[model samples]
Target: MSVLIETTAGNITLDLFVESQPLPCFNFLKLCKLNYYFFTPFHTIDKDFSVHCGNPNYPNPPNIISSSIIEDTQFQDQSLSPYLLAPKSTIKPTLGTFSFVKSIHENQQVFDSRFIITLSDSFDDSLENQVIPFGQIIEGFTVLETINNTPIESIELKRPLRDIRITYIHILHDPFPDPNNFHPYPLEPSEFQLSTMRFPELSKTTKDINSDNNNEYNALTLELVGDLPHYSIKPSPETLFVAKLNPITTSESLEIVFGRFGNVKNVNIILEPKTKKSLCYGFVEYNEQHEAESAYRKLSKGCVIDGRKLHIDFSQSVR
Candidate 1:
């Protein structure tokens, strides 16, 4: 069985292990069918670990009458196999492995509404019995990367400052039939439950480029993605690739020059390692998209920095 989760960032498709792990897989699929995951925020995002989420709408499982639901006879007494709970010792989950958040309710193991997606290559040994692996993200990994790189409020909370929610869950294939009383929402929820719809941008009327807090947010995002310390392929709308810089031009000078357009997050001037001299081309990342667009338009028109007329374009590679 497979399901497509459409989120604010993008779409993600998961291929579930329905045959081996039917109960939890059935629970997840049933939730999707009933639109129970609608507008559920990705409440926790541990950059080096995983992103967690579930039905924030309810604290406990819904009070459904036993007679209203149908049960698969084969899976009624079937418990999750030992292998599902205990992953291979040598094999660590490497990005996009989906699992249930195991918890103890009334002294029994329960896989409730919550789930988590692996974000890194290394797995912590302590979480071996804490989560049950039942599926893997089969598509939209770029979307997963986008969610993984999202900046949180702080190291302690791990909640995204802005909401990254599941807008819709589109179930592609399911072998089990729905219960008789199962009735799902006909349309997507209209209520917007986010603190902020999006990060603040450089507005058209704002005279001060540094007035907003976009720079801080951008900095946090860059730090989470390892862009500040090391170079990573993060080709985005706000990044610009500049070429033909004067050998004398420094990253600091580039920042000062570009700070006129908007909030300059970072300026990376590529250099020869042996000599530590400028290669005469680098990248300048802005805090917002329009700022980059403005910079691209104004600077692309024969702008000079240090003695060279800089050639500017949107960066396609990592610094």
Candidate 2:
């Protein structure tokens, strides 16, 4: 059996070892035919190691083609007879082979949709027992290399700097029969929901400004690092540029106005050289990045003080 995985990075074709690894191959092929992998990001990528995907929660619920694959249902339980397979010696894992990420519980190996594509030849030797290599990349090694070269997040978070997603899976040949009473979706899902142009933020919700904004700040931090890892560290004590301020707006008033959002580190109003009079602009620094972001989102739209409209944004000038 063979399948073609079309990703944002490129296309990769894999030949499945159906005879040697029937269970893994069967599960993989069935999921592909049903479009179970649609619009799922390659959440973890390491250039030196292998790229991992098949995050159960990564796929948008609407994009899941088959309702048969329910939440929290691992591949082992979906089969005809509930069974789990260990790594097979029949297919010695080599570079560009597909492998299931083994999860051991009670000293028994369990299979799931999550899988990895080998990048380095030494990968198999390192994870021989932990992963099951069920298929080999027959074509598109260039695409595989492209993904391997892509930049990733920190070692703690292996997310790719740019989202490399599986847009579609094309099953070329399948020797295995479908499971009993199984009805796969007839057509591929529309990309309207999961547009490749922009990586959609999942499950964002509005919350009280008084609530802890750590989660909100983390989400913004991830978005900012998408194109480049320019910032050496998370922007702490984030500064905001306040323009169109009332000529007489004092630093104390600015602090009072913005302090409601979060802790006010300091406020500096630009002043004339000799007069020390306000220049109608200033910078407000927040002790936390989320505070500045919250204040910006709330006050940037329309903030009026001392009978003048205030314009707010993150200060471009490095402090």
The TM-score values for the models, in the order shown, are 0.52, 0.52
**C-alpha local distance difference test of each model:** 0.65, 0.65
Residue-level lDDT tens digits of model 2 in 127-170: 68888778998656767777787766577777665667675565
Cα lDDT tens digits for candidate 1, 173-281: 6776665556776433332332123333323423343537544544443333332332233447888877667888889998988899999988887665456766556
lDDT at position 308, candidate 2: 84
Best by TM-score: 1
lDDT value, residue 41 of candidate 1: 69
Q: What is the lDDT of residue 134 in candidate 2?
A: 83
When summed lDDT is taken over every stretch of 10 residues in candidate 1, the lowest stretch is 62-71
RMSD of 2: 21.2
